[model samples]
Target: MIEESQPGPGETPPALAVSGLAKRFDDVQAVDGADFIVRPGEVFGFLGPNGAGKTTTIKLLTGLARPDAGSIAYFGADFTRRLKAAQHLFGVVADGNNLYPELTGRENLEFCAALYGIGRAEARNRVEELLERFGLDYAAGRRFGGYSRGMGRRLCIAAALVHRPRLLFLDEPTTGIDVPNAREIRRMLAGLAADGTTIFLTTHYIEEAERLCDRVAFIVAGRIVRQAAVEKLLDGARDRRIIELQLDTAPEPLLSALSEHFPTNRWEPRAGKRLRLISTAEIELAPPVAFLAERGAAVLEARRLRPSLEEVFVEVTGLAAERLSAEKGGRRG
Candidate 1:
């Protein structure tokens, strides 16, 4: 088991702390000046577009790659000089499989346990327990190479937990998996968080982060753009309301009136007689509705659009999540 730090009076050390972190690969500054603190038992999410240094940040935190400049502290202890000693305090589920393919599912877990110096009898019990916990009991005897993608991912997670780490670093755990399997993994993660495991998750899926993260940090161009509690970000974005209006006539007149009456609001025309109005400040729909009515334009529909985490992400990062995904995909192709 990991040892807890004796924090000073009125001070609680963060589960993980990073300041001014930076890493470079040849010509690229993959991670630059990244900083964040994760409180104990909190599900912290690291979000960014592809090549935005999400993976590099994880590498630095988990000690896979050394940072060019920064201080990394965990539970009030500086782990820079003693990375190996700190290994037992945290676990990592990398983006790709990192297990022996020739071994059976149960054998993989047992091997991981043995590496942690677990006794033979205790390792046997731990392996069995994890197999059941991850829903791999029946397939425990199957070779890992023959397991499905989802099953392999689940077994890898179980192997990471063999030592019961205090901090779990999950790097895109649900990416490329089937929907049902992804849901199961997410459910399991939620249960782990409820039981007080600090999770550090990295993902490109904004909706997944919206549902799972207590706090989220957005990184862009190798730097952290923003970090805040999920609720606070969503609540703050509530001020910026989007209203979509459908009119029988052309939107040129209504668009002009919007500029005259509500100059601060942004108005754009959409296909099929649709006018979208975006306001950074809270405003009633009555004014816009009345303006359109006065212009003899038949108002077919006018409704307020509920703010979503994706909108907030776009507002902060200046790029739509879908566009980012496409760009990443094109580069890969």
Candidate 2:
């Protein structure tokens, strides 16, 4: 239930608002006429394929780059004129290294604290607390140059929160990390959201965003195609049904019978005797399952899978995931 909150005669503005946000670099329109309102203390996800201008939109909001059109208001103030003063209200962590490689992790945190003008004692205490909280206490004395990618990511997040900014920007904060570390990061983010932090995260990891964000904005080719609650997106997806089956033996007759039972379900062969199935947007799994059971077929496993965010991404963009995967591989190569 996203109710629109109208402004009173004298009231504080929204936490953040972007209206007609458009940006261009020469002939390329990186962003186009984007408008959205981010309520305070909400976890917002930015979803887009590669080269879709998601990163560019982040830059415009953070004042790292200017927009050719539209206006951004932060904390009820003009974003351009008050950019410096808003720094205390803004915290950011983007992909790639943003810390000094020569400095130890503790030293890196201290430097950030100094930039935010915290006193030495307070800075030291905060650094220690964050290092412990992020499980980086063991690496606090190690130079960032020697840290693994996951360690670097953890330290970056810790540094971003040193000033306790009300709004946080995270761009692929868990990229290139193992599942355990990524899971920890997700938990930490949920905690922050619980503590009234307004988080805007941009990521290619659909599952991560689906788990962390309350609402998501799906962008394609510099334009927003969808914005809604995570549950709503899943409920609205064109591919919202998946059936899992375990069979005693892999039999063509059984497969044929199952296909005939639900002609609309997309059957996908898996390893062993397992089979995965998909269905159209309008169909429900209950009827299909009952039909199979009545036909005297032994049902091993059947459940509904909410639409994967990746499917939503592909549906909105009309581009296959492999294309984006190839682009990422090319960048690495």
Candidate 3:
């Protein structure tokens, strides 16, 4: 059975719920019948390639654009009908560097507070507090344009939190960040979830979603294909037995022979003289190793491989595994 993000009957109200959501621009249908829900205080990830209606869906949810059809609810209240009344409950940080470049980090946050109708005195305190909380106090006086990519991203998040909203929407929060800095950003987000902040996040990083989200929805070709809790998703794939065999020579020559000898196993020769073996039946180490040894192939390594989020992503989305990193996939998305 397919697990859904919808709350069960008599369950606590969802932080956000979307049903039959759709949108079209000109001749192109950007989002089609999307459905999902975010539980309060949990980090919900929306994952897709570029232009897979991720941005459009965010716009629809944030009230920046209207959907052609569907319903959106926040805490059981109809958000589509009462967006302005519930504005204070939300904070949004766009994917790009929207914070003013010329302004100092502290000043930009203060300005955002003012826009949120925070009192001048309260805004001052909030700005300073956010700077320190985000580890931007040292560069709070520096122009935002001079900040590193990671620092700028943190400040943008701090600006979004100036009003201390309950629900925060973040787009590509860690895109293009260096290793140490990206890790820092992820650590900060985990802390937010711990503090009961509901985060609706859209990102290109599959591993990031697996790490941070309680639940995740995969969007493809402008449609939501699947949604489930991260643990359940991983648990479902845990039983899949995948074995990788490394040899001194390419495994292509052995494919036909292996298929003939072990018809129950699926074999594919990969790059780097490696072969992937998949089977539902038990895989014995002896037969294949002995078979390869007799065929003048040197066996280097043989190990069971764990399934990953990327594998499930490609499976559910029906995208070629090789195209996950390709630009054509983005265009199709």
Candidate 4:
């Protein structure tokens, strides 16, 4: 249990805080001087391209690995020095199946609770509740090794919550599951956050993060490039006034002529007749509409577009968001 070093009334401390965190493997720096604070009861997303030190950072935060240089605090108290004592404060959910494959789902949860020193009666009730809540009651007696990927993943999450940790650390929560299962897992995370559990998740799905996280941090090459509330990041994105045009003809060929007319704007072709004209400055529609008309290309539709979170990610990290999605076997979530 966490020590009762509570802050004075009305003073809310961050759920987790890190300063100057650094980790290295051989000659490569895995995590470089990372720093961030996680507020109470918020879903925080750590986003980055592959090899960006996201996994290493989570390991450090969860005490699975020691940092070469840094300070870590949990709710204002330094946790780095008291790692073992702080074990009960949070739970980790990653790729591996930590539960015993030989055991049944109910048995796995009961054993997890036992590890936390919960009483037998309490463990039984908690296990049953978790099994039902995760929709695993139907297969409670099934061996973990025989369970489907989605079922096992759900059980992994249930095992983490057996002790009801105050903070949860998850990595790529929905990387390889069916759409229905992924959606269910997202709903579980949303419910956890609503009930005041602080959640820190690293994900490749930019769409999922945008939908679920209260705040997000962009990490690149072992460093945290940016961290802010989702609304704040999107607000900055809103400043870019992109315009989308649906033309009668394929817009790819017209890019050259459009460039000559609107040299300052960037033209990108989408599928078929959809064209995106992106610019930071205000985009007047009349000129482009008139130009298209004069060229005998009908302007089927012309609408203003807001820069997407994926586009903003590319701007900050200089890495395409497609890389993350593509590696995860999905383009959107």
Candidate 5:
């Protein structure tokens, strides 16, 4: 179980906290002993491949499904026993738009507001405000079924915000949308975070998580492999720098010399004038350059490649993000 330190008097608790979170679907354990915390006003990302228990965990957290075991707390209060009571404090925008197809965009928001018991007049004002805020005012009167994929997603998000919940849960918000729309949605999420809304975002897009999340957790095979702040992970990976060198020819003696000189570094010979070097720690480039010069080898090019979040994900999960995405996409289709 993962436990958080007690908050000081009058201090705000974390936005959400979980300990020993586990769930199963018959014999399959979808989530196995997960634990994590989301601080207030930060965008926390939950990332994993297909069948990694991402959606199952979300369902358990949001009270859509009951967990087989674990505790869930929201804002320092125990919500595990009564999730419905805390539902008013957060909003959820599911993967699919669960809106009435025949209803107009404006009508959908109004309907959502009504569910929250907002006054009729207030609902009208709130619906209009959300339509404008989400750039759906131009299509406010159009039936939801008539809206494009991007527009439908935007309206769904707007509907989720009808009551102005302090916390927002987005499950694959930009999946299947066009690049322009995805970019726009990311901008809007940033704006929301700037306005002090705590966002829990689950996405397959590594670039999206790298750009938007303050912290990220990697899950694989129903277990969390790792969790950390994005910057720290990236910065720490600098030590394992990868350098690619282009040579005029592959010299067996030069390779032997490099092995004798730097036994810790990994060397890979590539086809046609290319050699790759992976170092576990920062090393002087001068030595390698001098060694090549001494061997009378002409260097065509040299470049250093920085590790990215995608690489980090692959390293931790032992699975390629692209492969995971493809598998999940096939299942969805």
Candidate 6:
């Protein structure tokens, strides 16, 4: 018998919850009945294409935009009704640089501290520590407008953390960051989760989501197509592997043997005189390899290809991963 999965020990009314969430812009339905639970200290990854309502959902959860339908709950409290009080529950870093230009990075953080009612001395110390952690200490004294894109992003993150929020909303947190800075940011996010901070983030990078998220939700055309624990998805894909064989010419007998042995498996043509075969864990390749050797087929490479997050996304959404790349390109253009 199958049992429903219950929330884990650390989850209590969820760190964040959205039920029947929907949003609209004129006639277009931007988000449709989205529901998810984010547990305390878990990194929940939200993924989708450009017009997939990811940013809209983030705005609603962060209270930047009001939802047309549905409710948001945080720690057993109503999120929309307790907007002011709920402000202290989260830190947010939006995709854009909505920072103060005239003020230095230190000054921006101090301003945020003041807004959070943090004492001057405590805020100053925290700001100093954050600067050191993000490797922005050298540029802390420089005006934010004069800082590089990466530095500005770091400053924005520091400002968001001024109040020591229990949850963090990171929208494209590594967008303007360099490779090293991106790694550092990922490390910092991991540390925050380790210390009991729930993180809700949206990223287009599949590998980043696979590395950072305990579970992920795939959104498309304003709806979530599927969600599961990362391990479960990978394990399911691992049960099936793809094997590609290169032959000088079409080996009829070997192909016939493969068809006979693995009737349920799929066979397709690969570029440059190669035949691709897909089989499940139950099928052993040793016999097939021997058959190929006898048929004068040379083994160029034999390896099991595990499905990636991108492949899973494509399978679920019936859309190309290239959509994300196109979105990034359009943004750049």
Highest-lDDT candidate: 4
Worst 10 residues of 6 by lDDT: 1-10
Q: Rank the candidates by lDDT, best first.
A: 4, 3, 1, 5, 6, 2
**Leading candidate by TM-score:** 3
Please identify model 6 stretches exceeding 4 Å from their true place.
1-11, 243-304, 329-333
Candidate 3 per-residue lDDT, tens place, 1-333, comes to 235756889998998888889999998899998888898899999888878888899888888888999999988898786677667888988887789999999899989999999999999999999898899999999999999988999999999899999999998887766777778888889998899999999977787888899988888878888889988888877766789899999988888999999898877676679887877677887898899899988889998888767667766886644443343222111
Better of 2 and 3 by lDDT: 3
Flag clash pairs in model 5: none
Q: Who is ahead in lDDT, 4 or 5?
A: 4
Per-residue lDDT of candidate 2, residues 1-333 (tens digit): 222323455656767888789998888889988877676888988877777898899888887888888878887787764566677898999777689999999999999999999999999999999999889999999999999887898899999999889999998777677667778888888988998999999876677778899888877788887777777777767446766666444534456776877787766544556655666755565675565556555557765555676566666666654455345422111
Q: How much is the lDDT of residue 261 in candidate 4?
A: 94
**Model 3 whole-model lDDT (C-alpha atoms):** 0.84
- For model 1, which pairs clash? none
lDDT of each: 0.84, 0.77, 0.84, 0.85, 0.83, 0.78
- Ten residues in sequence with the least summed lDDT for candidate 2: 324-333
Q: Which ten residues in a row have the lowest lDDT in candidate 3?
A: 324-333
Select the stronger candidate by TM-score from 2 and 6.
6
lDDT of 6 by residue, 1-333 (tens): 011124666556688877788999999899998888887788988888878888899888888888888878888788765565688899999987778999988899899999999999999999998888778889999999998776787788878888999889998877656776677778888887888888998977777788889888888878888888778767767766677677776755466676876688755554456776676656567776676777787767666666767667766787756576456532221
lDDT of 4 at 79: 87
**Per-residue accuracy of model 4 over 180-207 as CA lDDT, tens digit each:** 8889999999999999999999987888
User: For residue 327, what is the lDDT in candidate 6?
Assistant: 66
Sequence-dependent TM-score of model 2? 0.78
TM-score of each: 0.81, 0.78, 0.86, 0.85, 0.81, 0.80
